[model samples]
Target: MSAPGEKAASELPQRLWLNGRVLEGRKDFERALENASEQERPVLEFGLRWCSDEPEMVLHTSGSTGRPKEIRAKKICMAASARMTVRRLGLRAGDTALLCLPMDYIAGQMVVVRSMLAGLRLVARRPSRRPFEDLARAPDFAALVPLQVLSTLEHEAERSLLAATREVLIGGAAVDRALAARLASFPNRLWSSYGMTETLSHIALRPLSGPRAGVWYEPLEGVRVSSSPRGTLAVSAPAVGVSLIETNDLVVFEPGSDRFRVLGRTDNVIDSGGIKVPAEALEELIGTVLESPFAIAPLPDPELGNSVAIVVEGTPDLPLPDFRALLRGAGLSPYWKPRSAVFVERLPRTRTGKLDRTALREAARSAPGRFRRAL
Candidate 1:
């Protein structure tokens, strides 16, 4: 594979499908950008960047767990990442791929790159909860965040449009049990992606629907997975110029197989007294009892060192005691049970739509009076 900047502009994709129009070459792309609407500008701007003479592009981390930062990635590595996805998903040339994510993000960038490289037509849309609102036809493939998928499933029309898409990739956040259950019957192929900006997009995919659907995430071709000393995931994908990228996400492998299951972030764990609890695992159990959007957070405790608390979005429908009782009845161990609850109008999220744990912790600590004791 050619190094970054080594490949000339002539080697890049010459055709682009912006919205409903076809743009060819640098002149066509530049013309469209000059006359582009606010919604269309991001796509066009990124298109211009991709076609630039620069060898590297600036990308941002999602900042779900920490502060967001910029990282420079080789264009050649990105192209290799795009090709891996195209081959793994069987995306054919002339097929349509939807671009509904923020162009500044890696997911959106990869969609455009994949379309360009594979000769697939690109369909750009404004990023919104209802991405399929103005769609006139189904796309051959589409990429969406978990929140968008959940929103689409709520409405009949949008849900049908999503189901008609030949392939769908869901990422940016974990897919909860309730949402996964609803997707089990979809006729089309739906996958939950596991990756970050550092990996270009996703190095692994877990099928959300079909007979192949399961809890484990299977690494894509040219990708290898291993566990760190701390049990976190480590990846090595030479195809994307990644020799090894260690992650803070805790994972468990399938014994002898390369397949793995993400348990939760090691930093998100609550060390209460001498016992350690994974916040995500606790949240998954809590989700079965409470259907609302909520997160398991750790609160300071003098005796236990740290105590588990539930941060719920919007107003709690039931009384604090009643909510605690419901969780207790759900067969939770003493360690997993939340000692208190906090209610906010909306949970804090990063720009990429991931739970902002750092901000969430600040919220829980800033207002002690707001906490309602579970007892």
Candidate 2:
């Protein structure tokens, strides 16, 4: 495989399908490439001759917690990933696929790569709030982010398009349980992809229905998975990536089974009074008892060293004691309950719509006179 930026002049130019029309052919595509290259100050060479055997594509992290940077992955690995997906889903040549995600992300790139590798026709559509509404036509398969899936569930036209699709893969963020339940009512095969920019998309796919809606992973062939002593998930796939990727996610292993359920991120764990508490697990527990969305983070506590605090999305109508009692009933140890419950209109989010933890911590520290230890 040629490295990124080294393309042979003899190689055929790639096509672009957009909004129900094949707007540009090879020559047109070349012109557009030159245009973008000039605008972006082309650091890499141009075209087949200039392109490498294994072309590199840079994926930018969403930067939910900090600034985003580009991570490079080989084009050959992407093709391998596409081939694995085709075999996993039983996709055949000539199948039709809809591309609805922003082409800038890994999820969107996988759609195009899969279509190319499978000899399937591609239909590219503009990003919209109603993603499936303006589809050129119903397709055999498609990939969506979680938010897009939720939007489809709420709209009749989008839902119809979704039902017509043969296979659908959803990722980019956690697939909320409520949204997954809504998708279960449909006839299409729904899958939740588990991966990241570093892994070149997903190394594992968990089906969304039929006895294993949210269970273990049926890993791609050649992908090796193992858990660390700390319960973090790790992967080594020759065709998928160059090296073993260690994720910050925590998982629960099922005895006598090959599957595992992702619990939360390891970075979110808080150590208080010699006990390790997963802030995400507590957030979900508190989310059930509270009326609105909230985040749990470790705040400085002179006594316990670091104590947990709750930050709500909006003002709560319930009393402080009521909230505390709910947690008590839920079996959160006295020390695990919020040291203080702070009300903020909305939690800060990153460009990719994930919680901004760094900013949230700062906000927690600046809140006036709200520090009261629960224990």
Candidate 3:
């Protein structure tokens, strides 16, 4: 077998079937780029690089936790990653794989790569909340963000199309409790992907429906996982060229089993008084009750060191006292309850649509008048 990152040119796929157009070989792919539309250019440009003699491809991080940075990913490793997913999902040649995510990101880029390697037909669509709008037929497989999934579920036509899709992978952000509960009854196969740019997409997947549906994520075959001293996840999957990646995500393993459940990110932990609370965990719990967009952030406290605050998008729906009562009703401890609520025009989010907790915390500290405390 060829070593990782060293696949021979002859072994690579020679043709790309993109959006009903067949472009064979590097020369043909390059020729079509001149007349490609704005939406088609990103795919063709990335395809151009993939067809080149370069061993690695340039990609960028989502910057959900911090700053987004560029990284060079090995093509051989990407091929390996594609193969793992294709094999696990039972994707066959000539199957249609939907590409509705932005090509600039790994999740979107991997869809194209997976199509090329597996000989699957690539169905290109602009990234949007309504990705399934006006679709004549459902794709055989697809990768979608949580927002897209939510939007599709709201409309009858789109929801039907989504139900008809053979398999679907939801990623790019955490699926809120409400959305997960709705997806639990979905007729088709649905999975939530757990990974980042460094892993070149998802290293683990949790089924959202069927008998396998649960909180724990099962790592892909050939991937090894362990909990770090800080209770974060550490991964080693050489098949994808990842020797070891120490992630900031806090996780708890299933006793001796490799399966694990992500609690939250350690960096997003809120230290209130002497107790430490995971912001994501609090937000997930709050999501079950709150219907609006909100984030749990740490506010500077006089004695408790840091106190939890709810930053909500748009105007406040319920009064401050009622919101506090709701939290208490949801089983939140006194320390876990938000000391106050802040109303913003919009909640801060990363470019990839993830909650920007660092930004939200800074905004809360910089502005005091925005916070309305419950008497």
Candidate 4:
């Protein structure tokens, strides 16, 4: 609809996969960059790369584990991944989608790519801890980090607006039990996605609410999951060009089942004498009783090779003995209970929201006495 003397709206450029800007040439893309906001520039740059004649573009891995690296990603493979999501989610033309994650990452780039391919109307917003404080409309779809969801749930109007979202995807980090408990009966279809940078986006999704909630992540269409000799996850999905990529995550796979549960990262396993203790498992146990931001990490021991220690962001409500008693009450194996506790101002996190274990371990090792004490 147009007012008198107003020109009709032009169709979005299919080649550049854009709706707002006219990108008829490289010059137009460059011009958009000059006028774009800091938050908007990342995706606009990505859009320019897509518009270029080159078949491949560089994408940086989310350095949650280690250093970030740039890898050449194919547009064809990216489109295939987008199409797979379209089919899996049953998205249709003109559906409204909220794009909030940083466009520099695959998750954010895929939002734009998917919306372009599926003809979904995109509403782009800057990434924030509170995702929808400003947006007025209830989008049909949205992808958000757990922190954003948690913040949104704290507000009545925000929660209601979020509840109206038809398809909600949570990722960028593991959704903890506490967060999952809050979303157990969300009005819409909520899923916790699992994937990495190399996979383009999620290859599996865990149901977070409804009757199907609380299960292992089921593989997406065209995805095959297996295990390596060391119990690490192996994925094969040619549609996204991933072939038998052995992940560092250790898992338990059923003999003939497609669903698998991730236990922990092999690198995080701590060996004390002959006993192997998984830090992730210990962290889960501690999470059961401790509400504050905390982690289970291995602290070097002169007697044993390493000992399990609790690293918390701040002081807990109860004293050390009470906390230890709480751990004992949780039925945490006597041998597995953290022998000590370390307090820090805050836990370090990677750009993509994963815990910065290397940084935390370094800090703990450097100043064990400054913040750590026997529990």
Candidate 5:
């Protein structure tokens, strides 16, 4: 419980709303702690710093781009993001929102922050076998990742829950053509947002509706976007904490517009026989050809410093010659295409549902003769 004087009206209480019933955070925490302790040690153990931190959120990068670094976003930034969202979506003070993502991440944290700031009721649920089962009634707003949306869409009742929401914010990873196509059929307002933990969540939102169903990054009032020498995206927003966050994300600016298309990460670039190859670009190419979830990465090579390899989760039996021909059809340079293709039952992912590059690299190395021949 917050100290008597410490409790502010703005402070989000634990038991805000659960289905139709309201549960208090402190009482719920005590019960949950007891229940969890009986079965095992705490699923999440936090430090004193986290408990006492004035900021509502402290998010860390997944280290996919580089080493995982801690980011401290003041509650003010969260409030600012909420305020922008409120204006953009025309949400009212008494509306409701359902939260499914983990609070440890920005997506979930923002829901709590927005609920507090807007004086809106928040419905909380433990991510379950069927997450929507916990929702007492339909909510006015909610945020979901691609995975959750796909999973919920597979079930009639779950899909009903999704359809009931007035607005749905989707992020965390790229939404493919298949998912996008399905979402297009729904009448609900689905927004594909772009942001990172450093940005205190999304600063740009594109409608996932008819005609406007493509990438559009409209910077918030306090935010700015620019490019670097390497054609990478750079973000400047007071709400982002840093003056300028130079990202490794590759982007191409539209000729007459501020919107840009995110190509992929600059760090994923590979050198094949003296040719510089962007692995992300190759992934896009392969995805276009194969129409499947695939990733292209660099394999250590003595001759070229780094050679290209392809990993696919589908159809291991697909012949290498046919796959090569697909790349050729796509007009990709020979060196930019994978030297070897390895089929895995499924690509391993992290807890946060991101590709585990370290695991992928190790998997590539362990494949017989693949890494050696690349070298």
Candidate 6:
């Protein structure tokens, strides 16, 4: 067994199907590669190398949970993942697939690989805030982030593309309640992928729209699921060559099945008066009302040890009592309802666009009154 980045270049694929046309012969591809933009060059180079006898590839995590880490993604694992996607999505040779995500990440890389394996026509587009913009044939399949979906649905012209798409995979972040509601009737088949860079992409998928709309994430074929002592989720998928990648994500598995519903992350747990409140879960619930960035966090308190609080972007327009009323109206317990609300000009986010909860907590702690109480 050769290690990753060590396999000697042996047989290369006959042709590269790209941008609605098949590039025959290596010379044609070399010319296309030379013309690739700086942003697209690296992944295109990677795709070329991956087509060789190389057994593995290196991919980086998104750092949404914490810090980004480099890990090896086995080429064999990627092929398996591609096969699973093709089978599950009903993709066939000559199908049109769109690639609008950054080629640096696994999500983007897999799009390229899937096109090759499934013999689909790959249409490459630079990743952007609105991936559906400009002139291009409607894609039979597409993959996107939740943020992109949110932005796309806001525009009638852009959203029609989603409706025309046969299947669209949404990942990279949890879908908030507001977005999920819009996805419920979204004409296309929408799926929420669950996995990380280490797993080569997703080991499980949950339907976000249509007849199968539900909370459970059904693991991919040949993937096993279990729980750690701390109640976090663990994955064992041979397709990805990962024996067990223990994750900080907390989930509730079905009584005796592999399907599970992701609750939140262990690190994001807010223990308020013995009741475990998943901040992300609460945030999703509150997302139905608040449009701007906001987060649910714990505030220091003497009696309960920790109290529920919310930090929203800009001046809080909704009255404090109304906010609580919304939570209560949604069946949130008194303990789950936020006791205090804080407003910030902007909710801090990490370089990767992840919510900087730690920073927001500090800001709320230091200047309690400035943004606290009512608007």
Summing lDDT over every window of 10 consecutive residues in candidate 2, give the lowest-scoring window: 39-48
User: Cα lDDT for residue 124, model 2?
Assistant: 61
Error of 5 at 112 (Å): 1.2
**1-375: candidate 5 lDDT, tens digit per residue:** 333433332353323333344434444534544534321112112212223335455677655554678876655556667777877877877789876676666777777667655766766666533567646567899888777887788788888988878888887776655677678867778888888888888877777765677666666677788889878888888644547888888988878877877877766777677898877676655555464555776777788877788876655555434555766887777667577666676776654455777777766767664322321
Q: Write the per-residue lDDT of candidate 2 for residues 258-280, one digit (tens) a residue.
A: 57678889888888888788887
Higher-scoring candidate on TM-score, 2 or 5? 5
Q: List the residue pairs that clash in candidate 3.
A: none
TM-score of each: 0.93, 0.79, 0.93, 0.89, 0.80, 0.86
Task: Summarize candidate 6's per-residue lDDT along 1-375 as a digit string, tens digits.
Answer: 744533232332435577645765445656778777754566567666675555667788776656678987667777778888888889998888888887777888888888877888887877776888873546999998877787787888888888889989998778766787888897779999998888888889999888988888998888899988988899998766789989989889988788898988988888888987889888887787667777887888898888888887777554444655776788877678787888888777644345666777776777557568632
Candidate 4 residue spans exceeding 4 A from truth: 1-28, 316-332, 368-370
lDDT of 4 by residue, 330-357 (tens): 7765677677888888888876667888
Candidate 3 TM-score to native: 0.93
After superposition, the stretches of candidate 3 with alpha carbons farther than 4 Å from their true spots are 1-6, 317-332, 366-375
- The per-prediction CA RMSD against the true structure, in angstroms, equals 2.4, 5.1, 2.3, 6.7, 5.1, 3.5
Residue 18, candidate 6: Cα error in Å is: 2.4
State how far residue 323 of model 5 sits from its true place (Å): 3.6
Between candidates 1 and 4, the one scoring higher on lDDT is 1
Q: What lDDT does model 2 reach?
A: 0.68
Model 5 has an lDDT value of 0.66
Q: What value does the lDDT take at residue 248 in candidate 2?
A: 88
lDDT of each: 0.84, 0.68, 0.85, 0.78, 0.66, 0.77
C-alpha lDDT (0 to 100) for residue 109 of candidate 3:
92
Backbone clashes in model 6, listed as residue pairs: none
Error of 6 at 106 (Å): 1.1
